[model samples]
Target: MAPPQPKAAAKAPAAPKSRVKKAKLGKARNYDLGNGIVRFSKTKMFHKTAKYKFVGKKNPKAPKTKKATIAVKPIGGEKNGGTRTVLLRRRKSFYPTQDKIKTHRHHKCFRKHERNIRPNLTVGTVCILLAGRHAGKRVVLVGVLPSGLLLVTGPFAFNSCPLRRIPQRYVIGTSTKIDLSDFKLPAHLNDAYFKKNKKSAKRSVKRKEGEDIFATKKEKYVPSEQRKTDQKLVDEAVIKAVGKREDKKVLRGYLKAAFGLRSSQFPHRLRF
Candidate 1:
């Protein structure tokens, strides 16, 4: 080996510096990393050594003051060396829970008290007609008019009476007791019933006349002559009606007795 190469100098290893130590600042619920790194607890916030500084004391020379109260002045205050006067300021009140304001509508213009109308005259009142063409009649008041006229209906026959003829005094609108027995229904004549009853009465009279006509007594002489003449005419009629019927035994007997005809006799045919 060539003169044992000058023994190579032994290489010296580089010295290792200390790893960054995790730091603990005061009781800030946080940790610090060496070389100016700060870690906030439970948050990912980080700060450099220069940016993250300790909180310092507040300034001590600042002035202090208390809150001021609001001031109210009178509206009509006098100026210096001038006359003073009084002024009133009124504000309308608003009540949300108060009852509603009352308003009236459709009040009657007709004064009941002024007119002396009985207080008892209410709606659906019944009244009677006192003076008119149909006096002593009854009616019902439908309403009171604005002109103080009473609107009434029926005395039945006197339904068309004017309002002027009706007196307020006689018109008893409110009565707890009304005797109805004296009141009669309106008179109405039925021509059909009258005609039927008259016809029946006439027929009864005719029947009695017919009986009398049939029942009159006959005079002895005149009646006998009449009987003979009537019997002859009746015989002719009977002979004409019967013809030549010897087969009817009862008819033959009647003819024999009525006419003086024998059973075997040849009778002449007589025209009536």
Candidate 2:
């Protein structure tokens, strides 16, 4: 078997073409240089040169309307030692249409007429316990609930009493008064040496140079003159080239120069 030198292995056959037809060629690709950068992709750029077309001849000079003339009223001085002395008059509203007028008299609830009937429950009003185990015990009506329930602040036995337990003694009276005029803080709690423990906190985020906090986020109306000729193409290229790899420094440079992002600004992750 060694006598015959090993013959060179036969080369593999090339792939055969399928019967499926190829796609037809479309329009030729258009290209342009944009924003001082070489852009290989194509894009249509346009600009507005004129306003609306006039239907009639242009009028350069036109007559102006005359200004209105009116007399000024004289001021009146006060007579009763800087006191106001003017007759007040109530005016009726004039309705232009008959449909707006109503036939029925409307009753109004005047807020000024509403009186504070809540009894003088100032820090002590002797009230009787109406319900519960201590139904007869007298309690001080410390406060009154909007729902007509009285807050009777008294002994621990009556403190646990519900609104139903509030009796005639718990009834709001002016007799029971707690003198708070000479009340003072206890000696043990009056320590000026007490101080709060300090802990290091995170620094607040600082905004970029040209940012306004209260400014409404408006749709950026890019003028035709200010817009880059091939911005879309450039952005598409950048996105495609920078796919997957997220180098913070490189991204910072590109974003700062191209999109006006500040380097010291906080980093935000880009979503796909």
Candidate 3:
């Protein structure tokens, strides 16, 4: 403490770093070899081989293009002492003229007209109708009509739906199927058979001399006898087929029940 500390030695300054000069990169150059030929060098001093020579001749002159000129005629002759150029008007056509003739070839259709039925849908399969007058009603699939429409029935006893045609796109195929292999469909059960007969013009009944038109009774509409017989025949066959199965009661109840979705029911998650 008593001895005064010697002055600290001054710190020596750091030596400066040596600056290095970067080498300049060389550029390629072209060397003329006479007779319209030239060779390119790989670098400023490195020349390529003779095989790398290219022709350096001037390009040939392009041919002159023809200019379109408009046809003009002098009007009023020379009597007026002045010439007025009038351009010839071209004949205008409503339809465009085609330079090339095209043959009338029939258009080829690439679309498929016939629809593929779902693997789950088959004859005698119980399906839920999704659209049309009988939507939500479960009906039995009879057979596919020639027009690609599905023929179905409610046996006319359970849901009151008679033999009718429905498009396959409007039905949801279920897992339930009835055995109708042994059952034969009547020959008249087809698309044409379902067509309604055109009704004749109704003739006005000769009203009594003072009869009131408002008091006249109207005729109630009734199904044709042929239709009733057809429905009975189809329903009998279906009921007979149902009777053959052990779960006939359950199947009948299922067909009679209407299809519906609950709050938690998701159609996509449903198997059928």
Candidate 4:
């Protein structure tokens, strides 16, 4: 028996309700096209009209703005030289944001404002080591050098900041400032001070005569024995300044929090 002929699918027009739900609606910006002709478009961005010019009876006179002028020195006379007035050209800046302006010296427009990345590099500033074998290590700012250099230390036994002068560019400065109120370290802290202090500290370690029987003969310390001693002294001052424990791990957490860094960001003991 022949099966009933397949029924043809009926075509149904889209309903108005379905079409309304599927359509997208957005407010478009109105642009001045002159001559009362208004255009509505999604491609055009909305902007407020520029400064209004008052010429009606409500406010008859237009306000006058003062002109800007700057003093300029003659060529090759920057140091101890007389200056002359240079009139600046006033123009309407179409830039929406100040960041769009370029920064340059000796030009019509000068951008004096700059970001000071290392501004927090003051005395007792705790920092994170950014490079070398000790990358990610923490250090405390104990002394500042006159040449804008930093004298930092890790209290080596704790964080490995050796007593050395490093350039400010190397370490990452944190807003967390440490205290050095009672620290009487000399302005010029050198390797000699560390060597001498370490030696004195080793001699101060008291040991009984019979204590050496089982003890292996200690090899001469290469700034090793004194490091612990210096660490103690450094830690004491640091603890006083920061009012918080100077544990390396704790400071690592501080660095992570201050910079909003992830644990995977700085690899521990990274040679880089």
Candidate 5:
């Protein structure tokens, strides 16, 4: 009785309730006209009306019209069976003829994107082989092939790499170039020159009655005499040209040493 009581908290006013209006649908009616004709009318919600007029009788037992057909002869001839009837319309193809033609042209036009070699990559330039069986080997660029590959050689006598064709992308061109004014590649060393001959199947030799087939030792593969002559000719020409240069010894040493990265070395930051 001695403490004053706090007044009751005032109640918040209530929000007004929203009302939604409903649409009323009207009745539909149909009127029958003379000679199998009928008119229909329907009133929809929101005061919208639709009307339709139909012709012909509404009997479910009426026969349907048949499609036109033609008789086609069988491929095996009339002896097996007469002609079979087919619809007049042609069958649709699974794919459009235009799309088929476009696909054929796309495949025919597909070709390797040719990349231009670096400006330093010229005839007589020294390049490092970056891929294939001769990766990391330094070779001399002799010429360019019709297929855009680089024709290079290790002079056979220096690094044992003979005349070969390699893609320009797999080679890193250096600033070094040699004097090849007097040296010229042989005319026979084209793309066809490197074409490998198909070896014939080994013939099974008939042994004598007293002879044992297992006694004969298998011979090791040896390079042909023609290949030896070619290698000798190319090596002699390249070595003679290199011998005339003042830095011949240095160039020989560079080609003999294989390319490699050392610890704390980055290829991008290093000079070729």
Candidate 6:
């Protein structure tokens, strides 16, 4: 019998594809507006890489010693006697990726800095801290920062309420207030604003003082500026006081009093 035809040679396996490594991505923080709209904080990203190499100077092909239509002397750092030549090339230009073109994005809005904010909570509003060392403690709302952080103060005479920024979600608003109406709010207030406040007198009507109503010269240096160290000490003390409390029973009691809730009350944090 005729020998069986040798089986067709097995086709060589196709070469495996080289996988391109995915670029590392940076995490972006998200914020929620009162409405359904959500805001993504500015992303930390490197600018796009240059697209094309920089254009080089055009020079005559022929050497200057040979003499040509163009100047024989090199315009740039080319051959010293003949046509000009480029020494160090310039940086390449930036080019965008195909993916970037598919999805166009605006980086930052002009209105990002201009806030038309009218927050419901104000300075001196009684708040229940729901997070951090000051969590479950009573704190007087300090002021709404431009960045929308609730700058709060525990005044930590007893509670460990570090003067810190609690996310809006962790702050529980209550009907209590510390009568800060007499206090003047500042433009773009921060934790330091509280320090200046402590050093100055409240904005109460000035009474007759020795019947001498003379123009008080405004000192170039205010005494309040010097109390930064003291303010920092207070902040540290408040944070320490809150962190040291393990039982937190007193803290819970304070929370209950601020919210006016009973043992059976299943009160949840108020969200706006």
The candidate that achieves the highest lDDT relative to the unseen native structure: 3
TM-scores of all predicted structures:
0.20, 0.20, 0.53, 0.36, 0.51, 0.35
What's the CA error at residue 42 for candidate 1, in Å?
92
Ranking by lDDT: 3, 5, 4, 6, 1, 2
Local accuracy of candidate 3 as per-residue lDDT tens digits, 159-223:
98888898888999998999988778788887788886576434356578788774544455678
Where model 4 places Cα greater than 4 Å from the true spot, the runs are 1-118, 191-221, 224-229, 244-272
Judged by whole-model lDDT over C-alpha atoms, candidate 6 comes out at 0.56
Model 3 weakest 10-residue run by lDDT: 43-52
Question: Which candidate, 1 or 5, has the higher lDDT?
Answer: 5
Candidate 5 lDDT over residue span 171-263, tens digit each? 999888777767777777777777665754354466878888855444455777876887787677667778888998898899899999999
Q: Rate the local accuracy (lDDT) of all candidates.
A: 0.42, 0.40, 0.80, 0.60, 0.76, 0.56
Expressed as tens digits, the lDDT of each residue in 58-105 for candidate 4 is 845888896556646465555845556565665576866655678654
Residue 91 in candidate 3 has what lDDT?
A: 52
Per-residue lDDT of 161 in model 3? 85
lDDT of 1 by residue, 31-79 (tens): 5676746555332343433333544745578787954443344454466
Q: Tens-digit lDDT track for model 6 on 1-272?
A: 99999899999999999999999986434546758455643332111222233336565687548433343345555555556544354545876565444656655575466543335576667687777755666776756776557877666454545456767888767665445554443443464454343444433344466754553433354535434554455445433444455744654356334334557766654341
What are the C-alpha RMSDs, in order, of all predicted structures?
47.8, 42.9, 36.1, 28.9, 36.0, 27.6
Which 10 consecutive positions of candidate 1 have the poorest summed lDDT? Answer: 185-194
Candidate whose TM-score is highest: 3
Predicted candidate 2 versus true structure: per-residue lDDT over 147-194, tens digit per residue? 334444333322333222232333424343433323222232211212
Q: What overall lDDT, based on C-alpha atoms, would model 4 receive against the true structure?
A: 0.60
Model 1 clash pairs? Answer: none
* Candidate 4 residue-wise lDDT at 92: 73
